[model samples]
Target: MKILLLITPSEDIVEKFRLSLKDEYIVLTAYSFEQGSDLIRPDQINLIAIDITISESDKIKSWFARHRNIQDIMWLGIVSSDISEEELGKYSSIFHEIICTPISRNRLKIAIKNIQERLDILSENKHLKLLSIAYTEKERDTESVIRLSPGPLEKAVPLFRTFTASLDLDKLIDLFLDAVTDVVGVSRISFLLYNKEDDVYRVKASRGIHPDISSRIYLTPDSGMILWLSTRGRILRRDKVEGDVVSKGILIRAFREMEVLQSVVGIPIMYEGKLLCILNLDRKITSEPYSSMELEKLFILSNYFGKAIQDIYKYNIICNQKEYTQKILERMGTGVITVNEKEEIIIFNPKAEEILKEKAADIKGRPVEVLPEPITRLIRETIRDKKAYNKHEVISEEDNLYVEVDTYGLYDISGLLIGGVILLEDISAREELSREKKKGENLQLLNELVGRMAHELRNPLVAVRTFTQLMKDRYSDPEFQDFFFSTVTGEVEKLNSLIEKLIAFAHPIEYKFDIVDLGEVLDNSLESILRAVKTSNIQLIKNYTPGIFKIRADNKQIYKAFSYILQNSFNAMQSGGTLTMNVESVLKDATIKISVKDTGRGIPPEDFKKVFDPFYTTPEKGIGLGLPLSQKIIEEHGGKVSVSSVFNHGTTLTILLPIAAQTEEEV
Candidate 1:
């Protein structure tokens, strides 16, 4: 098949060209003349379709000028309709067969077919000339023998047996090269093998030349020589001027290197219409050009090489896949161990070594019994039963290691048992965390008990208060009634206050919003708490800038919130310690902070997180509802409450409230 040099940036254009010219041409694509130059074989590229916009027109012209021997290269110029009329007209005058944009596959088909017919005629004439020359040579040397012979074709069955039976590709390629030169009686032979990695053909083996010289002969996929060899897929004669590929601009880099080695013939080793490698031969020892018979002998031998190359490719692919699978096993997180049907350990991954605390070198290829007893038993069971066992526990209480093990029966493609595999994962931390989480759930259940306690405790208190009120009202003795109302009523009031606080801590509150000055609110709370509690022995320090900050809140609720914090400080300082109260605006005055610091019996470090938990308290200090309730109210008003303490040193309780907008309303 002929190669059509299809130079276009658009993949769609290349596809359309290939589909349109599929019967006659193999499309070789390049984005520009710079890249397309390498594929311009004198024999293969008989047609070139160039997309010539204004940007590429200059390059196309210069490129055409560089290759002076393009007398037969039919140019199919493609131009977009978007170009200005002046440039279109100018380019039209310079090029023929210039198809305008919006062209269809059928239109392209007609144009390419017209050129193909001309190329066909030209090719036929060249072939006829070659035939005529061969006929003349044959007539002169009628008594001479076809000089070239394949050494193994001299023993044809052996060549087939070796090529079909051998597994090593390198040796097979060498065998093919050897057979090619065996009876040719030539000193120069070069084998250029394709390397998929770099997408080039380099000399793999050679004879009758310096090893250094042979190494320099590299043929890129785009090399004009390679294009001809790949497309023609037959023996090529360097002396055949009509089909000559190694011209000045044709082969480019490959042409120069091939020239250095004095190579005069190229044989393409092809199979299934794919070019696998190339062989270059020097002129015969008599310096005579190779006849068709000689070329024919080498061409037949290339088939065996092609078959060998195919087998080698399959082998490499299998090796790469195994390496890829091994890579996945090495990097995965789960521990994996596989053992053969004979119970010999194999394929111990890194994670398996880590879990078992043994080196792979020490354990692999040993008996499965070398592993822990549980792992060995599981693998044995999985193999014997031909089934999988998932998530069976393996615990080592003495070492505090807990693992979940899963065992599976390994099988070959034929479903026959080949081995067994085990998967392991550490679950010790996860199990411990689950137990701790259950304890927290039990604590949450305790909150439910408080609701029932409130109901039982409040019923008797209500009865006593109601009875005491009725008796006091009807007593008729002034002294007794007055004493009954004061003494008994006071104790009942304390009981009622405790019940209300308990209800408040467990439920949300309703607030009456008002503008309250934070400093004054703290002052009122301090005065009230000091009067209520026996804090006469404690030193009090108050430092605040009055009326500096205000908050939008319920006034009474704000007062109560401050009283709770103040009460905790006073309660902690009963033994004559200093109590400091301070109010300030912080965070660039975005919020107001009220803090009470007590230098007596500070909270221990361990109880810091429990400070705001409801009902947590000591007999000597206020109930835990004081801080938790204050936090609830502060958060409802878009604020935060926090506590910082040093063990046996002091505790500072702080409340932060957002600064509300100032108005005419005052506290």
Candidate 2:
């Protein structure tokens, strides 16, 4: 039984009450009301044996009233024998039980024992309430912290930016480790990236520890803890190890090497069901084991980190591909132009700029068609094909330029066609080289022919001159001498004609320009050929669409050029086939086009190109200088000639000429 005996002044009576209750129960005594109040907390007090006659009685009664509100302590009051029943009645509302002086020992024992039983029940209820309040407060604190905690997702922006900006893999790994260390509150962190090619895990990033320590650390499939965690793709904690294998050798060695006397946590970074790396963190600076809250945060952060790593790797691959493409473009002799779907040029490389004699800066955003005609044609072809096309040796007759163009389709990741790229190469130099080679070969053949002809003609001419002189000297008849002189003059004229033809074949035309109607020139030349071949029963067909077709030309030279082709057609139709002539105007470019076709034995395919070489001949009487000289004349007028022939079938020749100055006004 536990009893609280409050003995107050009126000092003699207080001592008497203490002596009575001290033997019967575990007694607690307070001598004053102030002392009594201090001792009467929930568990410490049960029965109050007070001295009723004391001046402090009302004060003690007030203290008992305040304690009653607490509901955990039993109150009993002590009184003097002189106290009246009415006085006891007045105080009855405050005290639960009251005892008078000169009380029996048995009565006091029973009272004290009864109070002790009540106190025991009260104590139990009080502790239960305290626990409930404590739990609620603790939950509130945790919720507050969680709400305030920087979420794993919040780091993504900076993490992604940093990861993508770093080119070096090691530097990227280090940044990832630093972010992990900051989040997890870990004292040390390290990253072990798996090298599938080597079949090993190499430590790549470390914090709060020297890299030398990481260098010394190595792991393989055979390594127990590392292998188990990596294979399971689970978060592993040092304290959670279950098996003897984890407890005995490998774990011990790892802990010792890492100098982690406290807790350790490891998480595997998995991508596409394959283990990519391991993230390891040691106990924090305070050596506290990682809390459940922190571990959960790490789990979320790791997911974000894994995705960021993949993005960075993908970005790097794209950058490297761009670099490789640039290198390839630089190495190529051709020019490259790339444009987006909007038809705006984007990638105009140095070679493309140089060939066009234009800068990328001046034309990048311009429409593709706004570029030079050659480039525009290439762009259009690429768009039409949706694949690569190679156009070799496309000659621009107006510019006298030859270029090769190769165009390819550009595609994106999903194999969707995006745009097109054009590769341009100037093949004019190569064409010129081929022409020179042909000229050299022809010159060699011509020199051989000329040497033989000259040797044969020189002796005959010398004999004729000598015979003419001898006749003049020996003949007495004047008429005979005159006939011998006439023979001499005829031989000299034949020799002079041969020499003039040789000179014409050897020299290229020198330009002399004047405005002339090419249509009228063609008409006059065809008329002359018809007259010359009057005996041949060839039908001449004319499909002439007359417009102001004019060009700047050396009129006589151009006349000769037209006459040579007309004569050739007349000669081709030896059995009198049809000769067709056509003329048309090109309005967009202000040029004229003329076509001449012969239904006669055509030149062979092999001889088409060779027919334009100087002195090349097929007919016994033909000299190839005619076609070659005609080509030179047309070119000098900023025009071009093209021929298509099928052997023994037919032949067609076309010429393109710029409009002359006088024709511009009429058009």
Candidate 3:
């Protein structure tokens, strides 16, 4: 039967052709040129017919020109219009017959019948040529070939039995040689294996062949027969291929390289569709050439040997991986323990054994009860819920150990929980460091507090002393006495207020959360600093968004924080400069951003980082608790204070706070 492929844009043509040829041919159809090009296999289809109008004639010609391999096949084109004699001659190479649209049924049938008959005659003649070559060579009787071996398969039993018991590739190759020796009088055997990294084929095993010949044979792209075997992956013989063009070209050159003029068989060993190696065997020069049956049996054995070598390579890889993994676990600092689904320990690394004060050999494969209570509980939780537990600290009083244990369930790719893994990290040193840091911070805070108190009190005390002296000297004067009393009372009140603020700054006070408007808070702070701004000839600019920007914060603390920031801006602008305070709400981030920009001399880059550190001051006077305290208050109210300065360009201090959803009355 013949295979016919029809290509056209019309579906009706494909269906009608398929029905007409249903009894005599296997019909395949494609709707586009691209689909037809992919379906054209020279070995499968006998004829190809393409239907195109005048517009797509050039497209089909280009497609045929590019695929020169399909040019050898029988191709016919159907056109929408009649072709002129000159144009037909021009396209004669692309299409054998150019038929017109609405084909004549009788003429098409007659043409197809002639084509089929011609193809059948050509196929038969090709088969006859191959048979003629086969008979010209020497042949052996069937009985004589069969008597040479008891059974080729039965001889391979020992090799198959040793496959599981050994991991030696060389021993398997030796066994394969012995199995094949009974079928053919083997003189020399050479195994050439391909190396992927080097891109070369080297002789791996050899016998009865010169060591120099095997060592010098490195198959590259230019290597004639070796490269052919790598690509074709077919069994080749010297006698049977002398008449064939392609095979003769490869085998004749390969035969010249052999030391002895005898029959040689080249078998390609394949695995996973890749040519892994080539097994070459040479029969004695005096003996008859190997029969077709023997050569076919050797090909099968070559495939079996390839699988054996592959298995050994994989086994060694797995063994190396295991060793590497074990070494890593031993050197790791963190303790590792793995338990199977039965709660029995499957692995206990060296660190785990050292931390727990137990031997790995003694506890491995033991129940979870072998571990301490805390670790046992963590493992149980992970196994029971099939989840991970992390960052839990455990302390062993008897061993004086403090460790952080993280547990996780080990699941396979299919999501089946197969085990649990626990990692233990020693954290005793970390805990000690934390305690010392806290102590240092507290001492520093105390020192800053004492300095602030002294600085605040000295001014008020000096004023009181001066007023008391005036009152003592001028007690008889009524006006002077009234002025002295009033001055003294004001100084005393200022002293009281200073003390109250110092106490609040130095201690932790319970904060009352309420809906406080940030804009109002800034206004109040600006009012307090307005006097300082006027005295310094500084201009103050307040740009507040027209909205009630409220936040859930301690009203008193936020006010204090705003006041401190305003004071800093006043102090920085010693000369006449502009201090712009801007307040805006960022609704997307749910925050209120307050920026206090000043045009005073910018802070030094080195001093910017320490501006908010307690007792860290650049000015000669005053303890530097103002900015630090402001930052602390804002942080306590769930806000942040950031300062950016560009040397001589002045500084900007911005405060961000979360916007409160409640109104002022909701407080």
Q: Native-vs-model 1 lDDT?
A: 0.74
Model 3 whole-model lDDT (C-alpha atoms): 0.73
Worst 10 residues of 3 by lDDT: 127-136
- TM-score sort, best first: 3, 2, 1
lDDT of candidate 1 over 1-667, digit per residue (tens): 4567878888778778877878767789988777888878864466777888524567667776687456667878898868788887776665546776677888888887777788668744553343333222343535553322333335444666787788787787677667556645566888888888988998898878898778776778888778877777656666665644445465555455567656877788875567888888887676556766456545655655576678878887998998998999899888889898998888899988888888999998999888877777788888887768788888876545578988888889999999999998978777788778988877775764466456545655676676577785678877767866676666577566566777777778989898877777878888888777855888888887557677899988888888888888878777788988776667685777777899978887778888887656666653466788888888999998889998888899887888886433222
Misplaced by over 4 Å in model 3 are 1-152, 157-167, 182-188, 195-203, 207-252, 260-263, 270-276, 284-289, 307-456, 460-498, 511-667
TM-score of each: 0.42, 0.48, 0.48
TM-score of 3: 0.48
- Higher-ranked by TM-score: 1 or 2: 2
Tell me how far the alpha carbon of residue 456 in candidate 1 is from the true structure, in angstroms, after superposition: 13
Candidate 3: deviation at residue 473, Å?
Answer: 8.7
Query: Who is ahead in TM-score, 1 or 3?
Result: 3
TM-score for candidate 1, residues paired by index: 0.42
Number of residue pairs clashing in candidate 2, backbone atoms closer than 3 angstroms, sequence gap of 3 or more or interchain: 1
